[model samples]
Target: MRRRVPNEVGIAAVVVLVAIVLSVLSPNFRTIENAQVLLLNGAVIAFLALGQTFVLLTGGIDLSTGSNIALTGMIAALATSAGLPWYVAVIAAIAIGLVVGSLNGSLIAYLKLPPFIVTFATFGVAASIPLILTGASSVNVRDPFFAIIGRGALFGIPMPVVLVAVAAIVFSVVLRFTSTGVHIYAVGGNAETSRLAGVRSARVIVLAYALSGLCAAMGGLIVTSRLMVGYPSAGSGNELFYSIAAAVVGGVSLFGGIGSIGGALLGAMLIATVSNGMNVIGVESYWQPLVIGVIILVGVVLDTHRRRISLATLLSRFRGPREAAAAAPTS
Candidate 1:
């Protein structure tokens, strides 16, 4: 059973190894303060990655996630400034996320548009929102109560990390134990076959993108809360990491319908660890982008390998069944 380690294992192992290496290289890396910082930084990315997993499982992508985050975050901040109740402002953020996500879903599923084009288009829309809302200025959320939601600690555990843990657990349970999860995988694996087999492939695709939107919103909230402000460009460039790294590293099939929640978390942690470690090590800030690019490329190669293996395995299963039929005695 343990002979062939799963591809997820590679991601998990690498995440752990990177954390350890970072710890060793920097004295501050092992401190409790650093743990909190890393966790806070990690939470939003993980949340977005969770959303990306859904779209990816359907053989789709959400380039708009980062922009969605910025837009949502900005809205939440603006609402708070307008004297809305803190909880109400938060709800507004989520509602915006749902609306944007559902829009992407509608276009892809109902209109039969390519997921790529639909999401890519929304990406521009999402990105533009912050600019319009901010008028090119960042919005700061300073209400003590609202600020607590973003930066406050509870019993020594950072709230952001807790939020991430909850999101992951819920997402994992839904994906592994619900019909909707199966629908997502089916649609991604083979839309025509799944549709013919009575699965609602189009609905699944729509739902996947909607889920992606929700995840991006949650991530945006995390960013807004942590920074106590929403920058016009908050979460910019994050989709580059979220879409490819989370899906690829988490064992989510690039072609659709395969993934594990734990793997996605591992992937997020790995990226966070690297970025944080590099910051602590005094590496030139400009060089981080190059390192990230290389890492993403490696993940893409691994994803391709996973797809090939899945295809080969399915073929073998088909061949085995045929061989059994051929060996049966004629009646």
Candidate 2:
């Protein structure tokens, strides 16, 4: 078998290549301000991608993330408009995610429903909820505190970027060092095996979904703060597609049991770079979807190949030196 580049390294190379190409194509793209914008833009998707990574790790998917964002953003906006404190609105928004995630976890864990179908159905229900509550109108957020979460800068870095970094650090620790993290991987790798080993598959699955929801809530809040408005269609379809794509591209396997938050962030950066570059270069809006689709297709193909390579490597290790000597010719 040919030597293969590590997933993160390959992705990082792609990021660098894309940045170079964009820099050449658009003189403005190389500026520090633009770099800041790229990071900020990527941060929102990165947040959702991180959550998706957790769910995907458990061999599950959360199709409602975007819808959850819409619902939570609307809740935050409405709360602030009703004279509630900004912090309180923020809490309320996150609560919406927790409730939705808990519901999804309960149904999937207890009822034995397919994760795909459960999340898919919830996507529809969650998307419609914001409209029901707001009568399909956009609610503007006038709170300065709410605005700061999106626009404020700390130590010369955007708030959104800082939050994303902090989240990545926390998740890295959780997934790498904690027993719950190991159990999550175990469940995704093989539920029966994990159960036999005394891991509570149901609770782990629930926790994964709950974390996904919390991430969605955080994403929605930042979006609302940035736009200074709570529109039911805010995250729209982008949340579901981008989050999953970023995670997958970052090295999170669709089949589950393998991936990292850092990888997902790199994936988000790649996608964000493409988007911002295309916009800066004045690519037609109609072609954007096609480009994103093609990139995702390529990423999926790469992931498949990576899996094959892993399997081959494992099988080769099992074929010991004695077997190899037996197969060799005596010259």
Candidate 3:
């Protein structure tokens, strides 16, 4: 009987390979400053990736992350502009995220709607938030406190990067050591089985989306702080890439019940590397999307192969069990 493929190992190898290739392609890609920039650029998406890890763990996807980023960023900026304390503005932004997440969860959990459709509808509304709030204008956040909160670094690390690291640590602890994490994986792995085992499938499902919303909110805030301005189209169409990259790269099974936060971070970093390398090599902006699409396709293919290899191994292992039973333990 064959053994299950080591998906994590395979993915890590790919990440390493990509990094090496990019380093070879662009001499500066291996430098510390560029490395920081890559991570800085990916901070928001990394936040999205981390949050998406939760949702995906429960066998779900979130399309509204980009939109949520837009909404929260603008809202926070406006709050800061209104003389709100920096901390207060941050809290308000988180509240907005909670509301948006709760709304998404409530509809799906209580109302029994499909997550994709619900998120899609919310995605549309969220995509319009900056426009609704600012009439398609950019809102600048000039509060020194606010700016420092996002742009400032501690011990030479970017604020957003530090936050992402913290979030990853927390999520890793939660997903690896908590009962809620088990329930989440169970619900995603098999809803019927999870319910039969007394897990609150509904709550888990809803909570997953809520967490996803918060992630997007965090991402938005980071981007806003970095840019110091909120654009209506700030996060337009970013959800697709963020979701796919994290899940595929992190070994978070699209089939659910399997993945690690560390893997998700690596996934985000890999995508960030690609974007950073392309820029360093002076690839035209227009071709960036094309490259992203191809990379995504490669991820998908890896996922496909991982699944096939795993299933084949499993089947091979089981084939002997049936054969043994049929042959009987006559010895």
Candidate 4:
């Protein structure tokens, strides 16, 4: 039998190939400083992608993550301006994310609502809250310590990058080794079957969305800390798009129950690298989205193809036994 290569290996190779091409095309793209900047810029998307992975694993999507970032950041800024300690503000922001995620999960899991509708409604609501609360104005963050979360470095790596790395590691372990993680995969693979097998599908779904919300909150913190302000329009741009694109490109199946945190991170890095390289090479800003859209379409097509092939292979394996038994003179 021929060995099949992992999806991650293929994506990683593509990332390296793209990086090499960019390095050759643009002298500045090869610099260490540029590399650090690229990683830093990609950190927020990475966080969102990580969170999306959990939700996606359960055959669900969270469109509210980008809006969650805006809402959470605004909340943190407002809390800071109202004389709350930085840590307190952080907690407040994270708490809001949990609440929103829980709400989304509850509606989908208990009410049997579609994940798309629930999260899309959440997206609108979360996005609107920041604008309404701040009256469409940016809230300034006066706490200097709050900046550390975004700007501080550990062992020469950017703080955001370090934080994402830590998060990826922790989550990777949990998904691979924990019962909750197994439940998440089972739920995503087949919710009805999992439920019949005694898995708490509803609870698993809720936890997935909650984890996604937590990740969005972390992204919000980094963005707010770096800017030292809570702009009501924050995360209203390409963040949500880029996050989904990154996850898809990283081998996460849109249908659910497939993908890894490591692959998602690689996908994030590829996106960041492409964006930065384009900027360095003077590609028009308007064209960047076009390129990313193409990437997304390709990822989706590939995912579908892989699924079909796997399904066919499984069917053939099952048929092999039946066909051989029938041909054995009814033995």
Each model's lDDT comes to 0.82, 0.90, 0.81, 0.93
lDDT of 1 by residue, 54-100 (tens): 88888888888888898988999998889887788889999999899
Candidate 3 CA-lDDT value: 0.81
| Candidate 3 residue runs with Cα over 4 Å from true position | 1-6, 237-239, 315-319, 329-331
Q: Hey, what RMSD does candidate 3 come out at? A: 2.4
Residue 143 of model 1, lDDT score: 64
Q: Using TM-score as the measure, name the better of candidate 1 and candidate 2.
A: 2
Error (Å) of candidate 3 at residue 2 is 12
Task: List TM-scores for all candidates, in order.
Answer: 0.92, 0.93, 0.92, 0.97
Candidate 4: where are CA atoms >4 Å away? Answer: 1-3
Ranking by lDDT: 4, 2, 1, 3
Q: Give a tens-digit lDDT track for model 2, residues 100-174.
A: 988888899889999999999999999999999989999988677898888988998899999999999999999
Worst 10 residues of 1 by lDDT: 238-247
Query: Which candidate's lDDT is highest?
Result: 4
Q: Tell me which residue pairs clash in candidate 2.
A: none
Looking at model 4, report the run of 10 residues with the lowest lDDT sum.
322-331
Tens-digit per-residue lDDT, 107-172, candidate 3: 888898888899889989988877987889998885767876568999988888889889989888
lDDT of 1 at 249: 67
Per-model clash counts, in order, read 0, 0, 0, 0
lDDT of 3 at 108: 84
lDDT of 4 by residue, 49-75 (tens): 999999999999999999999999999
